[model samples]
Target: MWYRLGQWMLRVILRVYHRAEVQGLDRVPRQGPFLLVGNHISYLDPFYIAAQLPQRISFMAKAESFSHPFTQWFLRKVDAFPVRREEADVRAMRSALARLRNDQVVGLFPEGRRREAEPPTELKGGASYLALRAQVPVIPVWIEGTDRALPRKGRWIRPAKVRIYFGEPIQKIPAGKNREDQERIHQMIMSAFRQLAEQKVAE
Candidate 1:
């Protein structure tokens, strides 16, 4: 299938060019309907994560990426769906949840958008909300050196060492929780991600 072929190509490319160094992959749930929450630093962050992961992971990409016909086709083929980020984008949420319910891995960048700087930035609450709604555990992943390899808005990709650290999944949000609890869940998710990102930088 096209998907399998693409994945294979990605694996080969990453292996040769990036020489991806992944750690703590065992922390990722072997089988899941799990949320992959991580910091987004470069355009290739999603693809880098996907290359290391064995599961079929889908990312919630920005709507603009899908504007071009060829780009849209490729994104869908690679399990990426566009989300109108200006607003709540309920349609995108539904599609993501449906995939999770079917026991698929869903990748999310808590920042909601890519950053141009070095250190990871503050995260949005969407990742927490998705985990809570889907009733699935959130696996916090921290990727390093991606920006150096493919800097933000840079056309040329320089071969660089990249590392992916997978931390244990956070507790799922309780059912029937009140609004206040939901906010707490969001804060907890962000805090956990912050810690993970910091640790990755320290290593």
Candidate 2:
């Protein structure tokens, strides 16, 4: 119940302070394993998404964030596992795969780092790799206004409106051992991001 309480508290804070709005939550699978793939903008991105979803998502976070004792403890408690960006972290991948095999949701930001101005054209391969390995549905989530709510380097949180869009899942990646399939999946994710952004614009 620490997780439930935290989710409730975060939802309250986000709704009241940022006027956060979430769309397409019904698109999320009610049960079973799935991968949540999204762009990283601000430090608050994970928190914003996590606050809205009832299914607890085990997010893959950067290893550096786990360096601090308090942060490590908190992240562990929240079921977040650290990833070493500089290399192919087999351990982290194993942990993620194990979780997915257990029919748990795994959250990942394929961009590898927070981007401010431009849309992500390139993404790390880990996301696609995991998708291929787990053979699970890939949910594309688009988060907007988070950068304004909490800028990349800004210390203070601003009262900017936040919106999250969840797109339909992409399933069935062709079996392959080469990088071609991974690239295809990556392109699919990029296309989904574009569509979600257009959705936000049309609104």
Candidate 3:
């Protein structure tokens, strides 16, 4: 109920303020558990994506955000759970796995933390790890113009046109050595995101 209400309110606000555009939603699979991975630009990336999508997505929030009572409460209201980013967070992984097993869509920022680097140099292996383990498809999402609207340090949000592109899912990972395999999946996802971003620019 909270997720639904939040989505409704956010949709109204994003439409009115950002004039956000969404494309390739039809590329998303209609059913079953899938991993939705996106490039992290602004803090609004996850929320913006969530508001635009019809179904619920379980986003991984940073664990520190849960330390404060109000933030934890608010995060819970929106159906987000915390993940420790410093090292391997067993609890968060367990939570994500459980959700995936239940046929739920899990959203992740493969770059690990929020970053603005184009063609990111290094990407954390969580998305690849989860997708390979869960044996589900990975849907690559590309979001644009969010940095201009709300940046990492900006206190005030300026109205900026935003666009999101959803690409087809990558179903199978090449079988090989573990490290090499994860790296392959990581590159593929990042490449897909760059493609979507490039496509958006051409339009």
Best by lDDT: 2
Q: Using TM-score as the measure, name the better of candidate 2 and candidate 3.
A: 2
Cα-based TM-score, every candidate: 0.91, 0.95, 0.92
Per-residue lDDT tens digits of candidate 3, residues 89-165? 88888898889999999998978888873656677888888877777789999888889998888998889888888
Who is ahead in lDDT, 1 or 2?
2
lDDT of 1 by residue, 1-203 (tens): 77767778877877888897788888888786898887787888898888777788999999999999999998988989989888888898899999999999998887778775344446666776777788888888888778898887689988988888887678757775566666777777767767776776677
Q: Tally clashing residue pairs in candidate 3.
A: 0
Give the range where candidate 1 is weakest over 10 consecutive residues by summed lDDT: 116-125
Highest TM-score against the true fold, candidate: 2
Sort every candidate by lDDT, greatest first: 2, 3, 1
Prediction 2 TM-score vs. true: 0.95
Query: What is the alpha-carbon lDDT of model 3 when measured against the actual structure?
Result: 0.85
User: What lDDT does the true structure give each of the candidates?
Assistant: 0.81, 0.89, 0.85
